[model samples]
Target: MRITTRRRLTRAGMYVLFFAVLAVVILVTDWGRLAQQFFQLDIARDQFPEIITIALKNTILFTLISFVGGLVLGIVFALMKLSSVAPYRWFATAYIELFRGLPALLTIFAMAYMVPIALGFRVPGGQVGAGLIGLILVASAYMAEVIRSGIQAVPKGQAEAARSLGMSPTRTMGWIVLPQGFRIIIPPLTNEFVLLLKDTSLLFIAGSTVLTKELTTFARDGLTNTGNGTTLVMAAMLYLLITIPLTRLVAVLERRLARGR
Candidate 1:
């Protein structure tokens, strides 16, 4: 046989062996009992209303608020970082690096605990508000980088052409560069939003009221109440339900962008 044929057969045999072992393990394991306890529909149904109100609602709210906040700050920072102005560039650079260098959990904790103590003023939702602020801070840092890269990816020729047509720098950026840059960045930004959706789970550490609780907290509370993991499984499914459509959108955007390339 040819060497290529032999190699293909060897790879196929390895895959077959892997699946055979997987099948044996699944058959030997108590998966039925595991499913009965963890995937109990009655327990999930009992917890569904609270899960929808607190977990799903709050998770969506956090994501939208953080994304909007991050997007606004991200645009400002991206422009500043790209500017010829020294102080603006320095400030934007420092802000981006400072937040990006820290772990997100640390930022969330500090915002929740340290900010209130230092400012001597409490926000509306207390810990949850603080957590949302932290999410915005961290997300803005990442988004600033993404926006900067997108802006910079616009060809210098495009700017020059706009200038030659008597457009001011601000107008050129607004009318030409940003529109193209945003198109290029859309898929990655969508992926970032998906990440932000998942990262909202970290807010559980900041403490939440019953209505303010996100998916992780809701699931955890249910786990305690029922002594079963049904809620966790349900929450996982709900997250998948929310995320899967966005993921497909990202895939479509990526494909379209690739074709443009």
Candidate 2:
């Protein structure tokens, strides 16, 4: 009859229903078939050493290369976006808008295949390199906005105070504004890194040799060779192993930043 008693009864009923469904699923599911398809010990074993040495190594390498390249380009565009010169602003806006609006896969495909045919330009590392360049372009567009916002969030007073002390605008921005902006944007930038790490999987569309294969491509190779899905599962687990900690770090940094504010 009481409100608290009714709430408790509702909660109890929900738990019962949840367990009933879970029990039914467990009873009806064929775990042996699932294991054969996705958890075969021999297939998983075959992926060892090479998966770690080649696949995961390539994934991390591509991510670092893309992030560094993207960060440099993003900083340039972010500054251009904030420039008083209209042409600089226009160019920056166009670049950011164009790349961000396009799918990353399409962009990578264009770089890997279309650019070579259209312009006869061979990116330094072949198709893999072209894919990396595409990723950098896409990443720079997103990061430019993040950097620009971070720069704008820095207090105007800070800049004014520096200017009053006879510091040049460039000097003030370099010495004062940028460091503060970077600190403010660290969490978002880290979040971006995690996203980019996962985005390396898209490079598979550009294709790879056994040597150049990153995680997704390597898993596909494993799938083909073994005819079991265990390699896919292994690759997924490795990805989670890398990403989970970074994601948790992002959350921690955000909370700390909020508390500081």
Candidate 3:
């Protein structure tokens, strides 16, 4: 047989085997039990308005707060990392390495518990505040690297042109280089935002009031109260609802950036 014919036969066999496995799994699954556990309409209904009004709201709010705070601090750190001053560079490097090396869960736990104990004072908004601080720290470390790469990716010719036009170094970076860099980095930044959104689920480690609980906490509480996994399914759907669009947007931005390049 020709090589092409052999390859086609192999491909056909793989496709047939894949569908055969899928059919077997579908035939074996207890659809009724699965539906009762994960898709009970009544159990899901119990979570309705509060899930959207409180849980989803808090998730989005926390993500935005973390992203904004992280973006600001990340810019400062990126600049410090890029600075000619040795102390600034060293401090920035240490911070980035320390946070990036640690698990975000540990960082959040420490911020929520350790710092307050060490300082003999409470973080301003309580546990939520401390968790937010931790999220900002982790997000900043990652964003700083992203921003630094973006800054470095800006063409040296752009800076030279600005300097030739008598623009001060600071002014040139602030006005010209930074803008272009941000444009180049938008897709990555959007991806980071999506990550932060999911990370809000980790905030349950910090503890929360009924009003402050994000989706994971809310769904967990619902699971305890209702004894059905439907709440978890609902939460998963909501997460998909938010993340899928943002991820698609990231893809679109990346494609556009690729085309622009």
lDDT of 1 by residue, 1-261 (tens): 999999999999999999999999989989889998898888977986778876899899999999999999999999999899999999999999999999899999999999899989886668999999999999999999999999889899999999999999999999999998999899889988999999999998799887788999899899998999999899899999989999999999899889989
Model 3 stretches astray by more than 4 angstroms? none
Prediction-by-prediction clash tally: 0, 0, 0
Cα lDDT tens digits for candidate 2, 123-223 = 89999999999999999999999999999999999999999999999999999999999999998899889989999999998989989999989998888
Local lDDT at 48 for model 3: 81
- Candidate maximizing TM-score: 3
Better of 1 and 3 by TM-score: 3
Better structure of 1 and 2 per lDDT: 2
Q: How big is the positional error of residue 231 in model 1, measured in Å on the Cα after superposition?
A: 0.5
Per-model TM-score, in order, reads 0.96, 0.95, 0.98
Predict model 3's lDDT versus the native.
0.96
Q: Mind sharing the TM-score for model 2?
A: 0.95
Model 1: how far is 138 from its true place, Å? 0.3
Evaluated at residue 167, the lDDT of candidate 1 is 100
Error of 3 at 27 (Å): 1.2
Which candidate number would show the highest lDDT if scored against the true structure?
A: 3
